[model samples]
Target: MGRWVCRLGPALLLALTAVLAIRPDWNEQLFLLGHQSARLLPAVFWRLVSVFGDWKTVIALLFPLAWQQPQRLPALLAGTALAILLALLLKGGFAVPRPPLVLPVGTVQLLDALPGNGSFPSGHAMASALLATAWSAHPKVGRWGAGSLAMVAGLVALSRLAIGVHWPLDVLAGALVGWGVMRLALRHAAPQGWPEEVAQRLLALLSAVLLLAVVFTAVKDWPRHHEEYWLRLVIGTGVALGGLLRFRR
Candidate 1:
């Protein structure tokens, strides 16, 4: 079963990517559903779920799981690193304007700013997918984890549209990238190791410190349009650093 999971992981990801990439219109409709769902769900509830759906949360959740299998830490780190690199590359390359910038649209009480670029791939979606993929190795937790991730991914993707930040295509592409990276990690996950209790404790501490720094930076730079960008960077960095620390003795 594990072997099959490793092999099928990439195939499933590729298939999902193709589906999302080719069916742009479908993504639009999906985005709309997400928007409506967001409206129906209470703001507090949505916000809570959104955290789980975010990439940083996913990585944090995976720390203990991956810590048990120190070998797997590398794959998770690689996946996270690639996701960050890809998100930056795509953001810079496309420079797609948000919906408000390109088309006049109603606001959705966004938690972040509208990036000054093209929205080809949803960074949030990609991060969520990558986290989901990394957790897919455990059959017991995989289903619930993936389902939770899907819910979060959908919300984040829709949040983008609700806030007029990204087109449906962009979210779809981001999801694809995230899923692909996760599969790569699963395929190469390492073997299990010692208890790693101390390692986990250290990682948790580091993650907390990094998170505080990010929050501090965001607060200090309040009202700036780049707050969301920096926030995500801080979160991504924390997750990556935490994963790396988990591997240390």
Candidate 2:
């Protein structure tokens, strides 16, 4: 079971990437499946479920994992950064319209306000899957943790479909980018020669600061629609401050 679980993440991600690359049109089929299935889903449930993939939620989830294992922080941060960067580049280069913009008017019911950007390769899916892969990096996280994280990432990907925001291919491709980046990070960027306890303490302090930034950003009168801004601030500020403190310790 453990062995299979270890292989599953890479296998699943690779499969999704390959299939999407081979048949991009298949996205419509999956989109329809989610679109029709979500018709009866409660508004409140979908809204709450969708939050699992939000940047704030991603930070909330990743921080704890990094705090517990500081050596894992580098991989986690690298995976997340790489996934998001790739997703952003793809979204811009593709300039694919979201369902609300492309679908016939009134065809799909949207649970949230429409975003004003290109939609291919959902950022929500990318971030959630990246964090999921990061968590899977540790053997101690175990099968149960991996399974739970997979479920969460699955739900987050599906939520974009459920809310009629992203096409199925966008979510699938985003997940591929996320998992692939994480795998790369684990392979080449794993922290070396760091004592676990010391790493944990340093990482924990840095995570606490990110949490505070999240809180401050949320309550402030900033443009909530500019989600990327908040994400950049959290990651950028955290890194800038963490670098200074981490080197000193």
Candidate 3:
């Protein structure tokens, strides 16, 4: 399983690069499909699906895995960090405008009211893929977990299109960024036995908090409001506290 994931990583990177180099019209076509699909599907359904790729939700899902298997923590951290860095670099370098900015007004329906940013290499897609790749690398998770995460990541990529914020190339590039980073980090996810128990306790507590946040978000209908940033901030604080606890000891 590990060997295969490692090999597939480079292939994905190359494929993304090739597609970008070709500069085909696939991006516009795929975006049109996403727009049409959203029109066909219930708005509520896609709203929920969008949350799965959100930063808070991704961290909520990732923290538990890291807590349960300490070895994965390093790779998860590194993969996510690398994903963010790469995503930012690509976004800035390309400076590509989002669909809403480039396409006809009212053609794109954005789920959120937030301001837009660079369009190349969808950040949400990259982050979700990073989490999925790191989680899949753990021996306890194996291929099934990886496959499930991949599906979730794919949904995330699609959600970007559905929301009309990103191009197909952006999502593809982000996915490649995530996959390649995780593969590199997997080589260094060794566990240090002494800190395992302490880190577990801290992370587990934070995970519980995130679970409660999920319930709160659902009850309050925050997804509909597109309050992803606030949710992410809360979870991010929890994660930081957990990190401090784990490292302080």
Candidate 4:
């Protein structure tokens, strides 16, 4: 299973990257969907999905599950951490402007700032893929769980394009990075018992609730200011640290 993941993951990434890079029409279609009329139903759905699509939210949900299988936690964390770090680095290096900031389009119902940073790889997409891949290894969840997560990851990748924040190719690259990271994590870790599993699930639920709270607050005050960013950072960091502490035990 591990070997298959290693072999197939890269191939999938490369294929996705190629499609995104070459297909301008696909991007145009995605952009068209962002129009007010087109976005009527989808906008609402994606926004709702975004709650789970967000990396922090998913992490909060998934981490506790990973914890029950302590052996799996490191790989999961490492994959997710690497994806975040890589996205940050790429954002700094590429500094691609988001659609609302650069593209001449109709009113985009932006959920958050099209951050003035790299748009090469959608971090949310990558993180989702990584989680899906890592979770694939568990006996309890197996392929079905992994596939469900991957499907969600794909939706997130599309959401980025639909909102015109990222090029289709960016989401593709993210998927690759995410899948690769998951494969690496799984190779090194595996889950353990029911108590730990329950703990992980509870933690995920709490994290999701907290994330939704923050997002709801932030959205209510759109065009988030520096203060909001700081608050989110602080709260998110605190949550992560708390989880780490719990994991250590």
Say which candidate scores most in TM-score.
2
lDDT ranking from best candidate downward: 2, 3, 4, 1
- lDDT, each prediction: 0.62, 0.72, 0.70, 0.63
> On TM-score, who's better, 1 or 4?
4
Please list the residue runs of candidate 3 whose C-alpha ends up more than 4 Å from where it truly belongs after superposition: 1-17, 189-194, 197-249
lDDT of 4: 0.63
Top candidate on lDDT is 2
lDDT of 3: 0.70
- Which stretch of 10 consecutive residues in model 2 shows the poorest summed lDDT? 221-230
Using TM-score as the yardstick, the better of models 3 and 4 is 3
Local accuracy of candidate 1 as per-residue lDDT tens digits, 1-249: 444444564466467657766886675566555655566655545444445445555666667556555556667767888888898898889786655554336533554555565577778778766776666666566555656655566666566665545667777678778877777666764435324564465566656665665566556666654324454555556665765565445
Candidate 3's clash total is: 0
Per-residue lDDT of model 4, residues 1-249, tens digit only: 444444575687698678756886765455556434436555555554544446766675565555556556656666777778888888788776666765565556665456567777788678767766666666777555555666777777776765557766677787888777777666754434235565565555555565566667567656645333444445565665566556443
Write out the backbone clash pairs for model 2.
none
Question: 1-249 in candidate 3: lDDT tens per residue?
Answer: 445545675476567657754865766877888777877776656666776666666766677577667766766766666777787788889888888888888788877653456888778877787777767767776666666777788788887788778888888888777777777777765434337665566565655566566556666765455545455555655665564465453
Give each prediction's root-mean-square deviation over alpha carbons.
Answer: 6.0, 5.2, 5.2, 6.9
Residues forming the 10-long window of minimal summed lDDT in candidate 4: 224-233
Show pairs that collide, candidate 4: 60-204, 61-204, 64-200, 65-200, 68-196, 69-191, 69-192
How do all models score by TM-score?
0.66, 0.78, 0.75, 0.67
Q: What CA RMSD would candidate 3 show?
A: 5.2
